[model samples]
Target: MNTYHIDAYKDDIYTCVRSRCGFCFHACPVFLSKGFETYTSRGKCMIMKAFLEGKLPASQGLADRFALCTTCGYCTSVCDVDRPEIFNAFREDLRDAGYTIHRHDEIKETVEKQHSPYGSPDESLASRFAWKIDHGSPLLYYAGCTARYRERAIAEAMMMVLPSFDFLEEAMCCGSVLYRTGYRDDAMRQARALVSRIERYSTVVTTCAGCYKTLTRDYPVMGLQIRPEVLHSTQYLVREYKEGRLALSPVGKGTKVTYHDPCHLGRGTGEYDAPRILLEAMGYEVIEMEHAREMALCCGAGGGLKSINDTMATRIGSMRMDEAKRTGASLLVTACPFCVRNLRDAGGSELDVVDITELIAQSARHEK
Candidate 1:
């Protein structure tokens, strides 16, 4: 019998262990922030190999080391292996062994009970924006947990920019958090429940990057496909703008703003241009960060790292903030609310961070 869940990744892990290229170390958010090899993709592969070889025992220390990753896929960008997949699987193995992170457990429990990791029933956030929900509309807006509870502006901006769209009466966790944190079974349950709730709509749009990826990509991977078409708010906005259906007033007279790609949106789903196109449409000058598009740095809150190790998450976020500041841009914008929250926390008073939806909403010309 396989000793650990990561046994499935043995070939890939062995390849990394033998290669020792260390290419993934270049910009791995956790490795960069923690300044340790154990946090990098190659390093994690080594740990997996040790476990498979029966040289390392499953323990909280080992679990903590694996939990440090942001699951950003930067390593996969440069290397051939799917590091995030391997890391997430390893986390599952650790979880099976009862070596899970405390905070992650709490998040999983809260999500299972409240249907949201934010520790409240879905009704709480939906009621705050009850005026936005319209069952008659075909287009439904899914403001993922972070946007609904943490970054209200993104959801509000999405509704403000869209002339008419339906909002789900209750907030639902997309299960992206649970999936990334090694609760695959629970994540699948949430996915099925959420798909059932929103499958009635003809079209579904979401303002959160994580939610967009989960709805469009991850769900299908789990063999549960969404019935309606799912579009990220940026994708929908850009398409509308292109068709002349949406009018955007110039928000900046060429004011420079840097864009940060949420890992899930950019690499996870290969959505790189929609958000930038929307930014340019709003008349804002787009400044490219050194690590933009496919190679963009993670905001540090992904893969449940923020909940598990906030200090390290913030440190990694600060590194991205520093990169944004170097461009001398006046503002920093990203599609993911989780990115906005973490970047804003790290960038406070140093650089301005806003969701792209907020800027687009500001530039939208609503019919009076």
Candidate 2:
């Protein structure tokens, strides 16, 4: 039993560190991958205690383990107290150690080189679909680096159904890559620049849960009060439908689907309803995994894990997708591009993983 972490975790970050925050065990894909007692939240707390007490110095493997965490906030959500800010505090620890992965390094390098995360976002990418940067609207549609690169279809879905908002697709990083990898200064610098660019917008929308949380919660702490608004597609869509802005018909008339909450969207930002609502509204028979909503498992691609631990990350994703499969659903719907990409790679057609927007678009009769 280790105790004493650091000044950042000096307080009872958890209401009761003694109790196992089994949320991770219940919903975390990483624990499923390792299955070691040490991989669970109890293990994480012990490890942090060792660091605080100087019993364990942060070694390379230890650092790797730390980096492996998806920072999904599942542990914190289940904790009665402290609520898991330790993960955020760990970013400072990584910065001190000067440890980073290629994903973070590549994106930060690109951001420093290019104005945005994507070094060379061709107009063709956006033009390939109907979505445009400026559609005479107040919202800024951030496609994020992942969607801009591989998951281009998700962007196309955004163009078709949610066409009413203004769009700003960045080939640039969201400072999330840097933030998660322990480059706080670089992350803040990028966040400031982004805040400057989008300050005038009435709202900011994103397809990436990572980007959504980064802009909504982290940026504000850095004095980037992004006033317009930050919303994931699911949330915005639900709002739109309620406001009469979106007319969601029963698109998934007969499809059976299950939803996997992105770590950032579900736990980071406390969003769990809009997506389920969207599925239910669309006539898709939505199924629930044992670990649903805040207790949702991570796809293991987050916290730069996909960058540093590809094999393990894929394994973790497979574990989660396996759970979706158990629900007996035809499709597994996720709101984050990272989750969608990783889950697809792991599933390899064993299951169908789709972005919420694309799922809707497939069955949707566009209003416009």
Candidate 3:
């Protein structure tokens, strides 16, 4: 029987076990919601130590505890020591011990069979690029699964905002869903496939935070070499605006708008300024949420948590919406399609949630 082991993470496990600092306690959304130490990073590390030392056996309950995390990287952002690595290692250990989440398994099967985690047979390689443009540029706009299927408006808005990029006709899953759900080998395979598809492009632009992070950060970490430079659409827009490639129409003065930093975009990649800069340039009053930038709260759609327990995900997203409400902004804008989807679902009638690209496209000034 395969058993949980921490040999690779011995140093991090020891540090977390010995310190018990609780620095990462409040940073974990799961811990805050569950009100249990077990849901916190430090607590999870302790559980890993126990399993490694043979004091505890790998069980479904333990697996569930690890799954509670959204893996937003907030704990690691605030921790003096590396917390994300230890948490991820524990997840891998859980999978190795014959424990895995059913939803994650389903996602893996879907991605393997359909090239999408959504399990929709309608979404094929051909359908992904049905809106392709032959701009004759070496730039490829990779509308990831979320943007392509779930948040079609974001993809359409991206095309409107920049009508000169080629869409990848053969883009597959970015494997972020697989990696975050502890299917490392499957994620690696997806990464290899994705790299081969876009390596010829000079730049790969993505509208999904998960895809941006996966291509720019996770792929290299997994030893997959993607030759093209990766840029988030927000980042690319900022450059376009700076280089006079794109023009924006200013909104009415005092038009209040707030920005929600998507986990993978803000904390995961430290890109909190470009979107705000664009908003400010568009003449909207960019109000900062109480938990803005590095400390921004997640929209609860990440790390496959939405698939596992949608009720919990909705609750978390509602909490974020409440914060956005506190800002007194008429609109809540985010750079990620996933964030827009969850925030819109949770915001309901109370708030209006929109992707930055949508806002930009609507306000774009087309020069005749």
Best by lDDT: 1
Q: Write the per-residue lDDT of candidate 2 for residues 174-232, one digit (tens) a residue.
A: 78877766667888888877777777888877888889999988787656787787788
lDDT tens string, model 1, 63-138?
Answer: 8888888888999988867788788888999999889998999999999998889986445655655676677888
What C-alpha lDDT do the candidate models reach, one value each?
0.86, 0.74, 0.82
Per-prediction backbone clash count: 0, 8, 0
Each candidate's TM vs. the true structure?
Answer: 0.96, 0.88, 0.94
In model 3, the runs with Cα more than 4 Å from the true position are: 1-6, 80-82, 121-132, 366-368
Candidate 1 collision pairs: none
Winner by TM-score between candidate 3 and candidate 1 = 1
Q: What is the C-alpha RMSD of each candidate to the true structure, in Å?
A: 1.7, 3.4, 2.3
Candidate 1 — worst ten consecutive residues by lDDT sum?
A: 120-129
Looking at model 3, residue 236 earns an lDDT score of 90
- What's the ranking of the predictions by TM-score, best on top? 1, 3, 2
What's the lDDT of the predicted structure labeled candidate 2?
A: 0.74
Query: What would you estimate as the lDDT of candidate 1?
Result: 0.86
